[model samples]
Target: MADVPALVLDFGGPVLLTPFEMAVREPEGVVRDLFLEQGPLATRQRPDPLWADLQEGRLSEREYWARKAQAWHEAGGSAPDVPVMFESLYSPPGPRMIRPQARALLADALAAGRRTAILTNDMRAFHTQDWIDGTEIIHTVDVMVDGSVEGVLKPDPELYRRLAQRLGVDFADMVFVDDQPHNIVGAEALGIPSVWLDVTDPDASFDRARTLMGLDEVVRDG
Candidate 1:
């Protein structure tokens, strides 16, 4: 670990587990189909594009949800059940922890006196109790910059800058890790180094820039 000491983490893909096939893709597909069938006008309104923008912080979640709900109502759907949809999207079949490798890396870093922090874009009201309950991972971090709490989301320079300020570290000394390429690119643009945790690729190596195969790696690398 560097003496300057700071590691910024993305919650969803790196620490909090995500069910790619079920919670993500499946729900996204279901929502898309629901929109297509009930709200044909959504095509003209471009709900998907709007959602992407919202995710990237180009639009507020409240605004996105309001517009989406209106579109669903106009399309003859029952307001698209926003809360239920989000619950389904984030509620994985089983809670998951980072793989042992990643955990080790993080542990090593922390043991070496590095500060660890999380920077994630998540809903304000979404409770993370179920995911962190009885999990040792929560204790590993020094601070958590939840987007909901910060009112700023990733892919935006504001979020990155705010986190660096809060941590009292320079952007160049901070390393951000997330599974999404766009997120990595966004952090890179702000002069923060990034690690892409591509869990989908069996042959992908996390060794490039302190990437980890799993949580164990974090402990070991740390």
Candidate 2:
């Protein structure tokens, strides 16, 4: 077993690709952001109660989005294809969504003798046991604490604590990497060091992560 100096990373945006993320960083992303974040009908990250539960893997995707579609309609937006759009956007087992930048950072971490794992809030796309272990970029890091499987998600101190316990490491011994600011805050709140991956430039993010974790292997220029 590798030394239990753990490096916990997020899957979406940071490691794996998702459509919602693509939309966020797209060339014309601001218009999409307005529709998704700033519009009158947008949830603005304030997910409805059911959607919030969905993030924690407590509710089925269908149940949560079905309710969300209703709310969108009531608010004068016609987003009836919420479920299809979500699934179709993030269809896994494809080449288009693979992100090697985060994978390379993980490989470097392992080479530096640190145990690494993936912690994600996902439902369908990332859970394929056969496919994930066989992929070149993905197979290097295997200890995954996925929300769909663990019934918890990031920004939840319980999940972070649970991961530390499962890895047999102290809270201070773990360094977390994610693309979300609030998730970073959550991890840091539990005394776990965290690295925030810049969605626009993951390479720089990993470099920043290395500095925060005091990792000195394979430094890259920003």
| Model 2 pairs whose backbones collide | none
* Candidate 2 deviation (Cα RMSD): 6.6
Question: Residues 79-104, candidate 2, lDDT per residue (tens digit)?
Answer: 54454444434445554566776766
Model 2, residue 65: C-alpha shift (Å): 7.9
Supply the global lDDT for candidate 1. Answer: 0.59
RMSD of each: 6.9, 6.6
The Cα local distance difference test for each model comes to 0.59, 0.63
For model 1, what is the alpha-carbon lDDT of residue 191? 78
**lDDT tens string, model 1, 82-130?**
5444454444423343454356556665775677887877733444555
Candidate 2 at 138: error in angstroms? 4.1
Model 2's number of clashes is 0
Q: Single out the weakest 10-residue window by summed lDDT for candidate 2.
A: 33-42
Could you tell me the lDDT of residue 41 within candidate 2?
26
Candidate number achieving the greatest lDDT relative to the actual structure = 2
